[model samples]
Target: MEIVQVLHMNGGSGDTSYATNSILQKQVITKAKPVVIGSISDLYTTNPSPCLRVADLGCSSGPNTLLVITEIIEAIDEICHQLNHNTPEFQVFLNDLPSNDFNAIFKTLPAFYEQLRKEKGEKFGPCSIMGIPGSFYERLFPTATIDFLHSSYSLQWLSQVPPMVEINKGNIYLARMSPPSVLQAYTDQFRKDFSLFLRLRSNEITPTGRMVLTLLGKKSEGPFGKECYFWELLSKSLNDLVSEGLIEEAKVDSFNLPFYMPSRKEVEAIVCGEGSFYLDGLEIFDINWDGSDDDDNKKFKFDRFISGQKVAKLIRAVTEPLIAYHFGDAVIDVLFNRYMEYVSDHLSKEEGKFVNFVISLKRK
Candidate 1:
């Protein structure tokens, strides 16, 4: 099998720095505990490799990344307790682009180490850890080295620019409808990127190693245009800014979408075609960015930030810089304000959104 490294350059999720960190702190320690438990149980029962040598492939240099990794470790430890198995040694490979903020990871590790001491007491063990900088869709681990692989709120980014988006050429979307060409362009690139991921990992992963991917995706089909609500709402805001002269038209033109979200079919097709992995499980649920409108609910339910079904807000932070770069500072403020308002309006019209999916696969 071929080996390659895929650059995780999307800055994690689309959330701003503060929001991203907060969400990570909340979700990883609490919400994902169960998921990680289930994932490990599935691995032990179904996978040939079971020692918990896990690699977080798209780990950005951020608190949230650490939070997730730490939680996964805790979950595994708890599971082993119930099962009465000797806690297996764990090696956590924190990966990202070469330019990631390694300082953040190093700075926080000591504190995390202290926290682990508090939790585990005399049983404390060094988290066999290292920072590996590179891409995942390309070469990553040594041949047959990794036992379990995981990535969250990543993998939605295309490894390269979505094909056929040349600047000199005409608009990729032939009309306001966003057209079929654009969809196919994004689809083909997603397939190519994902296929490379499977091929690259196939050799290193044990015959039945486990992998989990949690990422954002759209339900719509057509390209980014009037029909897709996300595209329409954002584009209108940008167009409104253009009309007000808040930003230059060239800035908008230069700004291309750095990532693409694939539908379930597109994702399934790509994985199935690879022939090295099989879908062990998949879940797609609704997520809404809008806070619940019920006044009584808002006082407490929304304040704590946990929702029965809420989209991952951290993903929004990762895109804020890109949003500011494209739309200008003034435009971004107006845009996000309008976005929240739009979410409210959308909730009024169609109800809330969701995080949508959690997919697990096992190598075959």
Candidate 2:
């Protein structure tokens, strides 16, 4: 499948849309706020520009779309206030695949601008936001033009599915049952894609510019871990449909996600090998599959059914476009219903969590 054409989160503001189902992503951005603030503050203090050019890569539409931007702007404003400097005019670029819901983001801009004006008063931003449609795997901006770059919950998506993963039959992603060759294919693909990403961004960012990236990652040195259990459950849900004759086994075999969760060791190796950026900081954290769950509350009870529904909706919003494109729309409801049940049962047995890596980079 052509990932550039096919890959995008579910668009619009409907119930099933990513706009409505992205609380998990919001939580992720919130968790990474300190790192983001620190990076932006450092970038602005060291090299204050009259016009600040910022690009948010893989910026899928939703409340989270502007969350990072808002933080960056606020950080800069705070610095300007403390230093008694003029607030730089902001030029913000929101980037995603051509298929993303740019219109949804566009519709919300007026309110975003108005809120900025009200909060910061008249002499503030004069910020301008625009949508850039294409893949970040390729260059998106002129050389040494961007002052700051940020991405969240997006880099794990590979440019395309690795070749010869047909051997990864009965699974949509890396799993315990996957063969050795399948694992190697995924590892090699991530290394290649991530290395290229660093090279491209290094060209676009100034020498002193900073980047903060957050994406799914694994704690183990090896690829196979509890992280694969999430995809394994989804694969089982599809197999359940195959058993009932609702989906073709061949179709399931042919389908594999264009995604890979890299380990911190792998990420560091690639960043070093790419030879374009200095790895300033790297952090790993975990979030429950159900975004709303309060992990800190000792008295909190685990509700399998509710957690199952929440996870199913979250996955569905992100994957439905691709799944519907490949399997036809008729199977969406049935597939997710089975997925919900499987996730619910799995949660009852064991709580599942997503491992995330947030890294800070600077151009060499």
Candidate 3:
């Protein structure tokens, strides 16, 4: 699959759109808020700029996109307010692949600006928001231009599907039963992709600039731990459809998502190997698959339909395009419907969780 062309969150604000189904991502942003604030605080303290250049890399279109930018701006404003300095002008760039829905983000800008004006009054410094369509794995900005860079729940996506995926003919991603070779292929791809990401950003960011990244990750040493089961379950749902002749088995074989959940060790190793950035901070948070909304309910009657539907919507928002391209749009709904059922059944038995990694880095 051509990831650049086909891989994108469901566009526009509809029921199945990523805009509506991104609570999990929002939770990730919330979890990383402290790190984001700290990074922004340090950015201004060490290298104060009257006009700060910020880029939200892999910033898919949605409310969360603006939420990130707003948080950064607010943090800067708070810092300047405490330090008795004037607020800085912001040149904010929203970045994602060319296929992302830039129009959706544009439509919401009016409301965003209105909100900012109301909150900050006349003290709100000049802020410019524009969309830049490109992959962060490559050079997206000119040398030493960006002041601070942020990406959330995005770097987990590999630039492209691994070339040696033929080793795991029956599966879509790394599964518990997947051989060591399959895991190695994913590890190698992530190392290559992340090393390139650091090198590119190292060139674009000022020597004192900072970057904060929040990505889906694994807590255990192996890949077959938390946050990795969702794909495994998704593959099972597709296998069921293949048995029922709803989709061809060969189609499933030919499909693999351009995604990987790296362990914290792997992230640190790559950062060191690249030798372009200093790892300032690294943290791993355990997030429930449903963003921890259902954690308090244990004795309550489990509503299979609602729980299944919720998880299904979240998964579909992110993976619909990829699945539809391979299985045809006709089976899209049917496939997700079955996936919901499977997810509901699994959640009923045990709590589902994702290991999320939030890292803070500085250009060398």
Best by lDDT: 2
* Candidate 1 local lDDT, 1-364, one digit each (tens): 0112223223432344533434433443344445555776677645423356778876776656676677667766776688775566667888776756656677777887788778877564456678888878678778877777877766766676565544412121223544466656766877888889888888777665778777666566544422235544555555566667886666655444546666777778788888888887777654334334355455764432243113223324455555654455565556656555554455455545434447788888
Error of 2 at 159 (Å): 0.6
Model 2: per-residue lDDT, tens digit, 25-66? 998899999999998998899889999999999999988899
Candidate 1 clashes: the total is 29
Q: Once superposed on the true structure, which residue ranges of model 1 sit more than 4 Å away at CA?
A: 1-35, 45-51, 165-176, 219-228, 290-316, 324-341, 344-350
Rank candidates by TM-score, best first: 2, 3, 1
In order of appearance, the predictions have TM-scores of 0.78, 0.98, 0.96
The window of 10 residues in a row where model 2 has the poorest summed lDDT is 293-302
Candidate 1 lDDT trough over 10 residues, lowest sum: 1-10
lDDT of 3 by residue, 1-364 (tens): 6789998999999999999999889988988999999999988988888999999998998879888888888899998899899999999999999999999999998888888889988777988899999888888899999999999989999999877735575689988777788788888999999999999999999888999999988878866885677888889989998999888888888777789998889999999999989999999887767664554555576676676787899999999999888888999888888889889888888878888889999888
Q: What lDDT does the true structure give each of the candidates?
A: 0.60, 0.91, 0.88
Worst 10 residues of 3 by lDDT: 290-299
Give me the displacement of residue 264 in model 1, in angstroms. Answer: 1.9
Residue-level lDDT for 187 in candidate 1: 67
